[model samples]
Target: MFEPSRIKNFVFVQKIIKSELMYLQKISLANFKSYEYESYVFSERVNCVVGENGIGKTNLLDAIYFLALTKSSISNQDALSINHEAEYMMIEGSFEIGESGENITPITNNQSLITISIQRGQKKAVLRDKKAYERISEHIGKFPVVMLSPNDTDVIRDGSEERRKFFDGVMAQLDSEYLENLLQYNRLLLQRNSLLKQFSERNYVDDLLLDIYSDPLVEVAVKIHQAREQFVTQFLPLFKKHYATLSDAREEVEMIYESEVGAENFTQIFRKNRPRDLAAQRTTMGIHKDDFAFEINGFTLRKFGSQGQQKSFVIALKLAQFEMLSQQKGFPPILLLDDIFDKLDDRRIQQLITMMVDGTFSQVFITDARPERTRQLLDNLGVEVKYFEIVK
Candidate 1:
């Protein structure tokens, strides 16, 4: 027989034991972005980077984002991240993972180090404790980080590809298998498109070769579609809850996922679409064409929502992302705010500060152009904060 009180106590203890937080203790940058050579020691709770425009405040946050995601957050071109006068760039961060309490202590009292570098003509490299990773993908999710920036509005205002990328990025951090399937599906899609292009050029269609490509594509697409569907279902409630909190329960917002593979036999659909795909010289029906629609008050946010409403919508999406990642990964992720104070209203900014003070978030980095304003805003929060001032 199980005693209810005892079982509850056991579960609480287990939760505490598993609630360890991971944060960067120090970071070094060489020839990256706007900095020629710089190093920063971050506070475990909050660190603010302040500078005038073009002095590299955002670049500092992007460096931390690169360490976690193994890619540049602001640009897709890795070469562009290197300083123009330098031939290569290197970023190294030391992290601590440990149990949290009145005095947070490292479980092993040892720090883990991650180093990432890119050279002009060589493959980018990522090292864990001086050992190079065989594949960069292996480095993601080990230390999850979420970034909220002015550009987040693009998820609501931009095309479907941006929305797809946003959700795909969130899903990738939460599920390694989804990342694998996404990579494989993208590869298969390229191959299928290449074959279609070749067939169009040659004026000949081989059904057998098409079938060879189609079968594997459908297999991967089904997995990707199913994973996305499951993620959206789980993500909606969290998004709604956060939106209500941000908006004081004044508006109703919804996220709708649209995919051609849903409620249909994708295999048959792929076969049926072959003729049109050949005509278009691309694979037009798959997860690649999926979209996420943002709605407020039962209408498209892009068309109907005000600037404040849109800002709240995107912030709600990011906060929900943070919560989802924390729940899935057993600890909160490092949150990055890039000039967010300029984009969000005072009320929303206070809400974020309250989260930091209440320990809902373990580590955070914020950037601002006005140092005094940043200080004034955070002073009332009663939390320890570190500030870095960038000068040209």
Candidate 2:
């Protein structure tokens, strides 16, 4: 997307990715995960992190990712990202944006300093160029990122919650309004669930008080459901296109979004299910139960697809995410590949390598435990490739 590479009859080329102008120029980490303190300068094109297994390669990638999205890719709790030897954590990144080239030095005006820090028993802080943001949500789309990992297949094979979280994250990165709606929905759901638990413990039913929480919860749930429905409609075609190109065999792939809120009787059913909800001590019916089902040839992918097929499907999903975010944000997001070379088969790895070399992506960060294999593959790519060799 960053250069005019001739697109041949390749493995995956259904769409022409646009020009990418954003890239991370540098990053520093303090008391974050495995790094007590570390800093590195990066190329504008491709970066590979090489190390032995469990030697903090993925942690380095997550630090870059944390600077982009202001959140960890693996853990949900910010405290968990803090080093065991420290009481707080900090991550800082310098990004060269608004232009595209092989320039080693970025213009001061074009560089952005993004920093995130968290202390125990305090709110995490996210800042841009030393000025703290009033709302961290404002930083969502500024530095978009897509992380592909071997465990991503769990989004397909695992419970509905994983699928919801995966798609919700994708939608949140692109749509601020949808992100706001999702946040509100989650807050309302939590409050309503607390009320249900309270009702159960007290052995009392306060219909009027319950409505106080239910009304807003249901209202926001509808909005969340609509957003998700619209997202699936827009995302499915791109996902299927990528899958077709990656698999090279069109077996009729589909992503179907199933939600209880789509039913006409959703409100009635929700009200009727209060007793059941109270018994379970949680909200039982809403967009929270929504699921995205992957299918190949009308059969459930999770149950029917082979391991390689599942990997291809999830990788396609991530690639579709990358393409969509690039189109929406007008620049390609930073791509993070976490131990994917060892996880993916030879054919898929070659396809990915070709894409990275031939300019389908910009500012890519890859993690591999095998340094020899990584060097063998990336050494010949005619691009600005840099390797951060980690030694534990």
Candidate 3:
């Protein structure tokens, strides 16, 4: 889908700054996905994971993602990560913080250990440096990561919920306050919906209790709406810049945030929608109902953009996400590319290799089914790439 004559070339004069980068030095997996038990040591600059299709390259990357985020990048179910024959899963990663590239391999200085284990019908346990975190979400922003894969195309092709989830995940990682507010909003919404159902089933309504829920829900909904608006404003320039470069400056693209919260009678609308809400047995209007309209030259990209254009758009979104997180966190986040080379042409792949040398990312893990192709691309680039070949 990423058809292009030539990927736009970026002029980057910046040099690599290693002291602020956080990178994974080692990782171990047990009963996780396709891995029964495995341990890997990674290079500080670039790690190339090469394996035949279905040989678990992506699962390996997911292990790293799970260690960083305490959940699967591919799904919401922790049970799915367990091997078919196993009842539990465990992943542990050793990371180095604020270390220079010149530091010795497996440098013990400033190292941190993060481990997560999940068992049948039991909550996942997470420990950082052997001390448990009270909540899993608290570990999210501590070591941020950005991942790009073929599945990212869903953010454009799917309905509104997919788009909201992608943006919300980005916001949650960059802003802790935003994450806290979003968690609270979702909790309140669930309870309020249950009360609505209870009111209808029993033919009883407590106006005071309803009012209590409605007031707080409305307040947080407005805050989320506003935060989303601000996020889009800040995110626009970066997204547009990356999109323009990826597309070679062809076609104009825009993202319009659609929300009912912008209405002057937002609070009144809640009061007005109560009867309908009771009939529907759900909270139907709020920031949860918001959507993002992706447009190419004022037309919906989903409806009009070509296959090549859509792929470029999604990749650009991830690139912008990388830039934003790096800027906000003061160090680049670990980048995981899941066999992306197979999707791009030699010329387009050159753009990514160039960015690697320009310090666009601190540490990157790339999976390629064809090791020769990866070698051909990096052979003369003077880049340090450590290759890992998996055998079935």
Name the top lDDT candidate. Answer: 1
Give lDDT per model, in order.
0.86, 0.83, 0.84
For model 3, residues 319-391, the per-residue Cα lDDT tens digits are 8888888778766788999988878656557777877766676688999899898888766655678999988
lDDT of 1 by residue, 1-392 (tens): 12343123123223432457788999999999888888889888789999898889999999999999999898999999999999999999998887766544345545789999999988899999999988787787888999999999999899999999999899889998889888888888999999999999999999999888889988888888889989989999989987887776899999998988875677787788888999999998988999998999999999999999999999889988888888887777899999989888888887777677656777889999999999998766666789899999
2 or 3: which has the higher lDDT?
Answer: 3
Give the runs in model 2 whose Cα sits over 4 Å from its true position.
1-20, 101-109
Using TM-score as the measure, the top candidate is 1
**Error at 216, model 3, angstroms:** 1.4
Taking all chains together, the TM-score of candidate 3 against the true structure is: 0.93
Per-candidate clashes, comma-separated: 0, 1, 0
Relative to the true structure, candidate 2 reaches a TM of: 0.93
lDDT of 3: 0.84
Show pairs that collide, candidate 2: 1-359
